[model samples]
Target: MLIMATKLNKKLLKTLSAVLFSAVVFVGCNDFFGDKTDLSFIDLPEFTNRDIAYVPIQPAWDQFVYPTDICIGFDELLYVVDEATQQIIGLDESGREQGRFSVPGVTSVTQDRRFDLLACGTLDTVSASGDPITLACIYRIRLLNQNGQYGIRYARIVNKIIHPFYSRSNVNAQDLTVRFGKVAIMASDIPSQNNRYYVTRQGQGGSSILGPNDAVLIFSNTDQFETPISVSTSSGIFNNFFQKPSGIATYAVPPQIQASQERHFFYSSVDPANELKVQFIEYIETDFGAEFRPVIFPVGDTSRADGFLFEPNKFSKPSAIAVAGDNTRFLFVVDEEKDSLFQFTRDGFEGVLPPPATGRTKLEKASFGGTGNGLTQFNRPSGVGYYRRIVYVADSGNGRILRFRLTLDFN
Candidate 1:
């Protein structure tokens, strides 16, 4: 009996030891195990016809063959810049094309009529080797209606308006925004001609020094506007830095948190060789100004080369992005290559809500892909804007304007 009791105690001790060992191993391997499975996207039902809003273009402004970027103004008007013709057109609320005006050496337009301001970036110079020159200054314009033909009455030249402070090229300020006496610009440029290493890195997939912007540049204080904060980098990853900075919007939550955390800014990027990486960066208002780095999403997280798993075979080249209202976890993106528009949402922190049920929304059948839309397929679709119930796209290649009004809600 004594020997049997001793044996039982020994068995219990061994079992307890094994359990403790297993617990330790489990704790240590949790992150590894989680990473083992593909967590970039969630396994959800393919999108059906649930969330979609498609509207046709009114025939007037449809004259553009290649449209570059779009802006919304005060009188329920839509303005589109045609880089090809150096012209800008206006569209009325009913989708009817009103008339057109011209801009000298102007390639883009960015403005919100509600704020009574507009801005654009110009390719000031170019090298004989055909490389684009620096974006010297951001031209500001004020929209006015002169007997129905829209006119740019107010203008100013702001020099060296580069945001995130790392972009080598300049912005097409037409991709920027002005609201509540604040000018929020998404300035992008490939690394400038600093050294041969910068050029080679951009060409050979090497590290880009000033390509990725360190922060969204802000020019505030006109009416008590504050200077912008800067973005930082812990990882050295950089290149094609600001290849495409489509849209800029501010997130203001007031009467809530401390004044410092009241506002945030979100911007988007579409990097192809970088694994078709579509990234959203958030800028927090710190003691100085805007602070930013890439925000990690559980889903849609992968190296720049994994390619978009959803459309692996199709060539995915995204261009523009816009956030949804009510501060939802969704964004509208345009793929210039496909000439199709996609709606993506954050499914928790781990998955991207797939494209809407209507599948891919077509802006115009003939000029839907490539750069711009017009009587032709989009030549080089570039910028996008969302407000109230409507969505706007910059049909850069076609020099035309396209608009879509959201008719359905996505739960």
Candidate 2:
């Protein structure tokens, strides 16, 4: 009985000590907080699926004219291509204009890992007859001067890749129809392939002694013409795979230091003839050599449906595409006809997954847009950019740039 009583007494003492400790902690907390009638506290850090909505950061920079495309440069600066003025407008992430440089006939702008700007535009020159002629050309705008000063104002035309002349010394009349619409820069650990880019050419379509006009042509870091990307599959190789490819994006995005060596790229086509608007081509290396393959998802089930990125007719006039090189690896596509922005997972799902608490097993559909000047609406939004968890859109028809952040990302 004495031993049993001693054990019971120890247990009771431990329970009492625990109760006393908890009471002291609670009282101390109350003492620290009770004196303050009003307290300021940050919202809970945990984000539930109910908080999964992309909200706009209002008061957009509305000073642009027909901004056709936007790129978040390797420098972490925002570059907007205003096609109407044929200028590339530079801005900080906060929407403040930094500087602007004009490129004749520039329709889209891309930045390489070297911080140089590659613009798809036209070059005005006199033909053999001394007649003024405009030809599709890719201009390499060196943002740094001989002194190594860097700024948009310091930008100068250091190199030019004219249509047929880029490949051969001679230029022909048939090459006149070729237009370079977009350029996507690639980063490779291999020195020889570093800073390479792919340019989309459109206007003519043919398989001749010269490659097809409507195709994606690769270029070296020196701006020299490389071979076009040939999409090969189990069946065969396709030289003329792209149809007026409107936008091309590589895994190598901005931030010079963290740029990806990934050669895979996402490309979009606005051509009415292209039944499928957006496509992803992955680079695969084999003993035979390196070959590019297109990622194909079965769209067989009609209901194989809304959330899948490859769903039939999912996009209308997809003007541009951007891929996150960060951990998210999210995909962004802006459509002109639909006037909306779509987000997808790297594996091709429509939206981010919902939290377990949401009582939903599917991803929360977050893609949104419409016509108008409202905060979320975009008019002919031709470009989409991603950086630091923010989405920037070039509201072309609205003559402005708008930004958004997912509520779950807010502090």
Candidate 3:
């Protein structure tokens, strides 16, 4: 009887040890490994659809074949870029056609700090020797009043060529943002081409050629191309690899931060898995010089890629992003594939981590315009812009611009 009891006691001890060991492993996995399988998608607040306010389809203006971008000028006018016509059409706050300007190969437009209109496009100009030179450049235009009529006059052109040896075809300026007299341009490389270009503060004349990657070229206050931030480097803040950068936006960091002098910019790219990825980059003034580096922001207890707040399946081919100027907390992302508009608060991702953390960076609101050519719907919406409390969407398929007023009830 004693021998049998001893064996039973030994077996009980072994079973308890095994259980304790399993518990330790489970705890370690939760604390250290961040067991993503246990995470669930965040339940976001429902978006209530209000009535669509205005749809600008002016018969006086040429039909928009493909409106790629839109921006609000200091004059409170909406500037729409028609890629098919290579022209910019201006409209008043009430959606009345104000005027239009011809800009050849114009892809994007923005207002500078000085209230001058800056446009990025491809230009063909003659050199001193009468040789025709086609270059991708930024044109500064001033809105002038001629006999009570508004007109656009060419201020100057910044020819973006780092070296003469490089073919002009290598430089393609897609999107740009101008702030504090500085312009950050997203210049995409030719598809399947490995050569890249970077701009220096020394002006377009001092631009440099990088090996190959999608890059953001920074133009200094003097209107010179100053630095190139690439996505291929492991050193900067963005350690992830991405290609095919599509859209860009710039926002100002508050003065209280340690790096207040720096400028914050966001660029979007398609990852290898075809996921739309957006990252936040900062132009830091270092001891060496002004450099563009990646930044990480707080997300819950852990941190994540600064501007990368979306999940892998969050967007299907996100084409454009726009941040609200009046309320910086609002961010709008347009998915061209699904014809969906996702709205998120900047603070929504505070405690969430990626990989099945569905609710982590909760989407504050979402609007789905089923694929159609209707007044309320969008067909292949390409770009979005927000100003005041109004949201402007480039309904490219419908050949018109749609404006909507957002009514959020966070309560």
Candidate 4:
């Protein structure tokens, strides 16, 4: 009877030891339901359609005066042109200021595949009467120093294409009144035309159509004059196609090797008289060399397309435009008059198509804005930029830069 009692005691002791070991293991590991695991995006179906539109990315960059334009360069850096400061400020993806370069009257900027900045600004020259005159100019800024360092502070204006002087040696009365708008750095598979860029010029033209005023003019990679764009429409080759064109964009966006080599671009016009304000032009090779042709869209044909980019009287003042370089190829336009940021699919639809199998048929109207300083609102927003799934807007009247990401892009 004593031995049996001792054996029971030993068994009880062993069981107690095992329980303590288990408790220690649990404590050393995670408590309760183990390490907290975030629910996957799909695990929450309640988010469906509720957060399907663009959501703000908090804490806007609010340090500028009349920020005219913003762009994501080939270097994957953010560049902003501030006309009030007459400077181009460069920043990292985190919005940290990297460097700033001063120009006379910098308004808009675009970077090429070669990483050179092509911007529209003003250059001052002495007239024959010994008076200083500022003419609209295109500047090719090499973001490199003599020591081979890369930075906007080290950037130098290697070349300047002054108005009238770039097109012809002589200047007309209307040339002095001309002002440059935006620059679209073009890309081509051909080596000779790879870095050529297009500049939007505007002027009174002396109330006549004698010159290339209010036109999109092309320049060679070497900064030589190419030709003004003559868009081919259903009405044949139209020389006077652009009216008050202020914004231009190309598909040759950053990360260099991944950029498209297509000679196509999207441009925006602020002209109040035009029915359509935004248009896309493609460089197609024809039997007679090459010509720029406008890509037409079917309007009011819901069965064929939900929306059309060529819809008449759609925009009041589409001041700035951006073409997504990713697989999405989305287009972004910001209207100053309407104070709105509009998004579109590659097919010119008004919004992003609903995700597969959500019991939704129509596209979400992703465009939004008003005349306030809200997260989704803008005050005379003049610039739009896109990279990856993020969109950046230059709220010039508000003196800030706003960023947003579509909720559909959430992981």
Query: TM-scores across all candidates?
Result: 0.52, 0.84, 0.60, 0.85
Give the lDDT of residue 265 in candidate 4. 89
Please state the error at residue 37 of candidate 4 in Å.
Answer: 35
Q: What value of lDDT does candidate 4 attain over all alpha carbons? A: 0.82
Ranking by lDDT: 4, 2, 3, 1
Number of clashes in every candidate structure? Answer: 52, 1, 12, 0
Cα lDDT of model 2 by residue, 1-411, tens digit? 334434755687687678666755665665575743322342222222334667887678899989998889888788999999999999888778889999999988988888899999998887887777789988899999999899787899998888778667665676678788788888888888899888888877554655678888888998877788789988899887888788888888854365788888889998887777888899999999999999985543323235767877888799899987778888999999999999987878787765555565667668988899988888999888888888989999999999988865765
Question: Cα deviation in Å at residue 65, candidate 3?
Answer: 3.5
- Candidates 2 and 3, the one with greater lDDT: 2
How well does model 1 score by local distance difference test? Answer: 0.43
Error of 4 at 32 (Å): 38
Cα lDDT for residue 296, model 1? 55
